[model samples]
Target: MSVSNPTLITFVIYIAAMVLIGLMAYRSTNNLSDYILGGRSLGSVVTALSAGASDMSGWLLMGLPGAIYMSGLSESWIAVGLIAGAYLNWLFVAGRLRVQTEHNGDALTLPDYFSSRFEDKSGLLRIISAVVILVFFTIYCASGIVAGARLFESTFGMSYETALWAGAAATIAYTFIGGFLAVSWTDTVQATLMIFALILTPIIVLLATGGVDTTFLAIEAKDPTNFDMLKNTTFIGVISLMGWGLGYFGQPHILARFMAADSVKSIAKARRISMTWMILCLGGTVAVGFFGIAYFSAHPEVAGPVTENPERVFIELAKILFNPWVAGVLLSAILAAVMSTLSCQLLVCSSALTEDFYKTFLRKSASQVELVWVGRAMVLLVALIAIAMAANPENRVLGLVSYAWAGFGAAFGPVVLISVIWKGMTRNGALAGILVGATTVIVWKHFSLLGLYEIIPGFIFASLAIYFVSKMGAPTAGMVERFDAAEKDYNLNK
Candidate 1:
């Protein structure tokens, strides 16, 4: 990258700051608990922003805006679904998970939680959940890698091949060094950058396009149906867009935030803060895409970049509309978005392999120091795998994220929700839910069935499997007692 270029310079500085934060957090990371879960010490604001940042990823700035730019408001049903889903997740799942995971056994990973909560002596739940985390998280990490590479390729004129490795380097470094605490701390900073970019970019776009009236007129002249939400769409299409919400219930990275919150009481305040941040960021994303339709229509001379790849709408707009120094700051938000989520995902994957697999089987009596090193090693191993997966320049951020998001939501969402609410949920039932949910998503996506989002089928089938398989047998008295105790604490805290 040229020192003469302000944007590249800003990116270097921002990445350097993140690594520095990781170094600081590393000193505090004394054991596996600190590395994997911040020793469950996050406060309300940190939990709120970190959760929102990790949840949005590059999808908020790149994928979702690109979708709206390509399809207009017809695509915004996704925003609606996501907003509703997020609020519900914070309300229903956040407190319960915080209480239950701690109560069950102070579990560090989702697999650990499942095995502990259900008393899976055979370790089947841990293995299956860990397998699912590995399979899906590898793909999820690739999406973040792809997003970062896209930003670097555009800004620094690096070839996609070179950008792939370049973009992933800093995220991998900090995550490998400091683990979860590093990821969460950086996420708070990234979330602030993302909102600033989203909010500022759109207002300027609207103003540049001669305000809302001229923008809407231009949009109408270009595509009359662009303003209609139900235009050029089927019932199934709308429902499919809204189905995106269901996936939120099952996302492991977001759930990890809830698990890491200091207490259920902190989660109460965090829910409010997180939802407000989410709604504003999402609204700004929609505004950027919607107003982009008007700006690009009236100024087709500069629209070729966006027309060729709609995902670059925000990027192209920032470079063209702002001064070099201002654009540098604005563009760093993309890197922030990419790194924040990618780092969290890498840490989560590492925890899964280390806590759930390596520590459980390879070294049952391993010391905390050994486990921490193993976790760090797993972060490197997973990042390399994700980089290789992301090397193909043709990968789309939205598509990769959708696949992984569905897998987690289907396989774990129903089980997590049901386990927390129903004392009768059995091990066999939880196992059945995971199998069916994961299977349905893969089969549905493979066959392109019903032209519907895979998460819907996967979530429904998993919930059904859990209910039916559970009814066929009785839960042990020990299971009922455990659930009651967790429920009592959850009620007291909430």
Candidate 2:
């Protein structure tokens, strides 16, 4: 496939800039702690943007805009749910987790945090949580890869198979090189590019389609119901869509940002900055699709790609509407979104294997330098697995994301949230919640039961299991004492 020289040059520059950032961060990384969590030294802006960028992923630019393009506003329940969930997570979970992870022995990963919080002597919590992270994160990583592949396939005219590998290459390179600091630093830049594209593309789209009113009229003329939130969906569908928010609690990549903040106080300002950025990006994403509808409806002759796969609406429109140079910059935003999230997910998976598994079981006395190298190796290993998962051309980014999101939300959300906030929650309770939540999501998704999203059932059941099982058992004195110290520290910090 012949590519536009301008776009090809832009992509080259963008990818190089990302790698340069990774190289810069490599100098700051000296130990396993630095590699995995930046030694918890991230300031407010870096922490906030990294959290937001990593959380959004390619799904923000590709899957989400595609979903809105095909299903109209009815699909935005996920967006609404996500915005609400993220805000709550920032408010309730961020500070507590930062303080708790520190007090719990300077934990670097979610599984480590869980194991330390519950005082589990048997290593069950660490094993199960780490496995869940690996399992769901593999799927989550695949979604980012698929989104990147789609972007590459459409933009550069690469075949699906070629695009899959090409799409994951840059992300894996930098993540392997720079570790957490690199991922976090690059994320801030990517987040800026993403917001720029999202904000700019939509305004251009609006102008191209005449205006907001004209766009609405075009949509209304085609299908008035397109503007309706519950247009073709059942109440169950609405509930399912909104359930996406619950996944925020269990996302390891986002939580890692919270844990990496310079201080608990940093989280306060980071929350405000993150939320503002998120709201703007999401609003702009919807605008891209909403306005694309009008622009395409009037120019059906050039809408073949979008008509064939609605997910390509943004990609197609970006190329058609902008000058070649501007289009190159706008299109790089998709790559930015893909790299930001994929890098962090790779780092989190790396952290899980290195901190939760290898360091814990293989070499209890492993050197910091050895552990950092091991983390870098794990990032490559997981990226390969995810690339294999994304090899199929028919895979949809949103579909892959939904399953993984449900899995994490169900398996880790209740456990993480309850463990930090409640002192009386027992080890057995945490274990039960993890099992029940993960099982429910897998089983519910397999059976297609109730036409409801799995996260809702999984979250509810997990929360219930923790409550009942904790009521049945009690925590040890040491457990309570540890919780008291963590809680007191959190209070003082907050």
Candidate 3:
């Protein structure tokens, strides 16, 4: 029960502000498209900030910091890998996804685009992709919920289960009201706040402990490995951790924002802004964790048991520095990171279920109004499922987040990267790629592999399976013609 009165007051104010923003955003949304894609009228700043915020999330606040606290400098490479991957996603995927998505009758969902673009008139691709989105995103959202629970427990001394529901309810309330417009706009605001908090916290913590010289000296004094870039991580561990960037290619929540951009031209500006924000925020966060190790090392009594839970480093620092007001703002920044991402993902998952699954397969004649309600209902349903899984706070949110990311990356990354460039990608290939990639991830994650590698093994085997299967089967004539025409025009623009 380390609840400071000022901190509690600040937390209430932050929650109120977020709820207000969600209500304000709700007024702007008029329909499903408006709700899901903000009517495709977003600017460069909103797109960049939303994309970056959603991509980073609890991992940025918890996972990145924890990694730095545990392993030191080597963890920075994960930030590097992510920044590089995000830059490429913006450069290569953003503009094209925007144009092609609109050209294909303004498709709103990933499965919708996949089915529509390749003329999968049978709707198999849409249904399959939608199911994958729902399944993976459920787990993904669970990870975020768990992160929220951790934040509540860390900052407010609340029980994990109570914190879990509160987190889920707060996230869903805003998302249901504001939809995509609200989520993106709030994400932009949160991203700015996150960047400020990360930068300021590290500097202040470092300053508190004498200076940079003393901070480094203290970290080195604590553990020699803390000073080494290759600390504790073997080559395999290093590569696996860093290779998390691969998930960028297949993330639906990320791609949906890109596809929903108002114009391709916005991507260039968005990239510059997005990359700058990511590097600074992620870089600063890692530095904070490293600084925390020293801050606690010097004043172990002040930090209490926080040193054990690396995620609490930021909260612990907040309690130490500044007035209650500033600390509240800092705490809100962490919640902002959690809520922004959780809301965006909930919307994306809901859209997939309503548009791709229910309307496409379950009810072909569903009206827009009915579909809208279904989307809302689906959001509630999925949020509850995530909350149920999140009850056990001990589960590693970072590990779950990583597995979900890798699963999506392996399953759809190769398929999507190929769809953009290779004209010969058949329906069979896409289907095979999705199945093989998804199956490999599941098996590798749970079952003991028969003397095979871990994360990378799945990616390699799945990718090869897709390629090999495509070669053996003749291209679906319908898909070959459609893909050929689309590829020609797509190439000409490039």
Candidate 4:
């Protein structure tokens, strides 16, 4: 249970750097656009890395390792699926979103873009989408908080409740002050830290275990199944799990990065950098988990009692194998994963409440000053709700994150994709898709008798709902003209 002082020092430095970035970001904030999207001037490198890090979240630390540790190479396919999905999303969505968002005149939030694009004069679609964002993101944020608590509890020997609050407050404080710029800047730093730690820790562990061949032999001698990528992995279970990549199609924080990029041209470079980082980091995480078996077989006590909690694989390895300084760096890498995700969710949630609801409906003429205060207040509210939810301290991080993720992916993913590509997509179709998609996910997760993965049912129902509704509902002549005009203009511009 003992941890080294050097590890604590490394943590202090990482936390200090995060807070400083937030304080500096506060100086640049003057309006909603600046606070939420960095004034639409974020460069390719910052946008790409920040978005990827936030998207991966604590799952990169806790869930990925836990999967590899318990299930072995069978789980690596999830990383493969995710990388492919992310590459496609960036290629198809990033540049167009950046161009169209700016073309729509400084749309600061996702709901804002939806409202403007679909011309939701009654504000129904905007309100519905915003509510969905808040509900699922609250759960998503709570998952990150829980992961942070677990990390602190494991490394610092703190109580779960204390760690939960410390993690939430630390992330929220800087996010509240600095906003999007702060989040993006810290994400870049954290992403670098996370990648380095993931790579170095595995290499150090592999070398210490007498190289890859010996390491494999040791692991195989202990558990033959640990080395098999297809062992005990069925088609449905594999597809249902790895289909998590589909959730990327609709994640607000991820799209927010696209919307904030300095220009459309930067997206190509951004994609290359982001994909390279993801492949390397995710691959390293898988190796560390798989390699831990061999290392632990040689020296079990030093690795601690990891059989009880697979999520602690990386932390246990750090404690047993590395010097205190390197262990601290690794711990910070996990924290970086947690903080990057939490900050993004908090900002997205606050934006939904402030721009989508409070300003859009409650106070149409609210001042910039009032809007900023409202956004800050919303951040506090979202944090409190997530803290209450994370009180259990043992809720699986992937379970919580996945539930919310399915909600977003099922409800908004199809609508976003169709709206961008199909001129025939009507407002009613978009609204129908959003409602059915969101509702299906909620019901599938909590009430369905079929017992399928929520995303499977939710996604299927959502797609059908959009198609049926769009086909039955007649498009007005003006609406048809607008669609035609928009498509023609888009083609001409391209």
Candidate 5:
């Protein structure tokens, strides 16, 4: 429980640096565009790292490793799904979305894009999309809080209650001070820290356990199934695991990186960089968990006693493998993962409330400066909600993340993909898709049907709803014309 002074100092310096970045970013943030999308000026490196950092979150460090440690190679399916999904998203969706969103009314947020893309004069589409974002992201943000709390609880030996608030406070301060720019910049830094920690931990663990062969032998001795990829093979399970890739298309935080890219041309380079980063980071994370099984099996005394929560494997290994100062920096990487994603989630929610709700409904005439402050307030509001939701120390980061990921993927993934690619996608169909996807995910999750992941059913039904409803209702000439123009713009850029 006793953290060395040097370790405590390291944590403080890292937290302070994030806040400093926010202060610096605040100076350049002049309008909602700057606040929400960094004036659409992020270069390839920032865009790629920001998107990677925000998308991976604490789940990458804590949740994924824990799942791998607990369930063995079977959990790697999620990583496989994510890599494939991320690549496709970059190849098919990123460049087109970057071009089309800018062309379609210079949209600042996803809700703004949805409303503009479909020419929904009734404002229903914007409202529905914004609601989905707010609802799912609130839960999504709570996963980060849970991850942060877990990190703090393990590292600093703080109470869950104190750790929960402390963990959230640094993220809130930085995000509230600056908006998208701060989030992006901090994310770049966090991504670097995360990759460093992920890569180093596994390598050190492997050396400590003698080598890979020894580690494998130890793990196999503990449980032969640890190496069996087909231990619990099922068609539905594989499909469900791969379905996670579908969630990337709908994740607003990740999409915002694409939307904020400096140019369509930048997306190609960013995509390459992102994929490379993702592959390395994911591989490292899985190794940490898989290797931890061997390390602990060889030296169970280091772990103290067996616990149900295998998520603690990473933290326990860090403490045992490294000196106090080195462990502090590595542990801060977990906090970095937590803060990076939490900041992005808060900004996305704030953008929804500020641009989609406030500007649309209450303050159409509000000045840019006023709206920025309102966005800050909304960031605090959402952070408070997520903190309350994450108050239970028993809450698993992966479980919360999976639920929110499914909600976003089902509710908005199909609609976003179809809207960008299909000109015939009617506003009515968009509405139906969102409603059906959101509703189905909630119902399927609650009812527990066939033990299938909710996203599989939700995505299928939502896609069908969009296709059928759009066929039932014709698109207006204006809608068709606008779609033509956006399509033309996309092709021209290509």
Candidate 6:
């Protein structure tokens, strides 16, 4: 079960190139700003691709395709929900958050922005938000590790423990060296590789399985339920699937791209590019899974043990469809997807620790260089924690992703959305929303309540908590002034 020499060489070259990019980015990283936010200098294309790459993670390749392979078309609602949510986040939250964060004390992290936005002198807002980020991101980071482990085990036939370390090593190295700039630059390349793999794999699968009609007929003959979109469609299922979009407004990694954009003006263009890439990539991901069903129907022998581990569909398909060298390159795209998102998550976790905790509480007078090093140290720490969590071979990448995704979306989504659009949102209201949303998610998920996704209940409760609490509390004149100024500046910029 050894890896082919050609595949090993391709992987080595890819990993080496990533490390080189980290070394190069090190020259430009002179301050904490540069280390955490790329010095707020990313262009539209890089911002769009980096954000998309970080948002998709290995779930885009492994978790997503696996879901479709196992569940048929009912799983696609999640994709549709994500596309719609992404568009709205870029449209509504991106420009406003960019201008607002810079205006409100030049806040760097999400917690920094939240504390400054409400003028929470007691630091309660900062503490709550930072804890939530660390907690959910730990789980989110574990999902990426699981995806990477699955990729290595499937492609190279390595033990899960060996594959877990191998998958995390390169990502942690680059992030430790270059920070945000390294993450963004490598993400651009990874994003390109991801799209190429998603697009090319499906096309090859279709060709090898004959035409579209023939593929469909074969799939239908094998199992008519595979093509039935309505087979498992229910009100709860559809809403829960589409609710995935709502999580976008609150995702710290994606919002970091907006905050780091060159200017508010660049966001519109970035949104268009990001959305286009997302649609094509998501469609391609679903196609790979759907086509795998057909291909396996025709040539079941090639599927091997994928019936038990359906996530291996993409890996198995590539091995059967392409030459050894080309298949190696295609498989490397999975690693690209894994690394791109894992690096960003680790960086965000670092920023939350360094900026929100260390700089704010431990040493308000710390030098920029000192803070940057602390950030790099935290990156390694968080990656190690995630690696430990991902050591379990039975973890399903999608299951981990869904839990963490719901946590972030429920905890932060309603508060973030309300903070930007509504001027009357008080500090107490923000605190209440964070606590209620996060608590609801934990409780709902732990108990497996009502046969519905935790996000639906968590999001509703959080939003309700914010509204009612804000109504009960009074906003200060200073808070009103700050909101007005942000709104005016946003309008003027537009």
lDDT of 2: 0.91
- TM-score, candidate 4, is 0.95
- What's the candidate order when arranged by decreasing lDDT? 1, 5, 6, 2, 4, 3
Each model's backbone clash number: 0, 0, 0, 0, 0, 0
lDDT of 4 by residue, 67-135 (tens): 888888998878887887798889777777776565544578878877766667899988999999998
Runs of candidate 1 with Cα error greater than 4 angstroms are: none
Write the residue-wise lDDT of candidate 2 on 420-458 in tens digits.
Answer: 889999999999999999999999999999999999999
Error of 5 at 270 (Å): 0.3
lDDT of each: 0.92, 0.91, 0.80, 0.85, 0.92, 0.91
Best by TM-score: 1
**Pick by lDDT: which candidate is best?**
1
Model 2 pairs whose backbones collide:
none
Model 4 clashing residue pairs (backbone): none
- Tens-place lDDT per residue, model 3, 41-120, is 98889999999898888878787887788778888878877877788778777776776677666789888888766677
Q: TM-scores for all candidates? A: 0.99, 0.98, 0.94, 0.95, 0.98, 0.98
Q: Put down candidate 1 lDDT per residue, 1-494, tens digits, no spaces.
A: 56788887888889999999999999999999999899999999999999999999888889998999999899999999999988989988999999889888899899999999889999999999999999999999999999999998988899999999989999999998888899999999999999999999998998898888888999999898888999888999999889889988888999999999999889989999999999999999998888888889889999998998899999999998999989999989989899999998999999999999999989999999999999999999999999999989999999999999999989999999898899888999999999999999999999999899999999999999999999998788887887898889988878
Q: Of the candidates numbered 3 and 6, which has the greater lDDT value?
A: 6
Task: Look at candidate 5 and tell me the lDDT of residue 336.
Answer: 95
Query: TM-score for model 3?
Result: 0.94
Give model 3's clash tally. 0
| Tens-digit lDDT string for candidate 6 (158-261) | 89999999999999999999989999999999999989999999999999989898988888887889877766778888888899998998899999999999
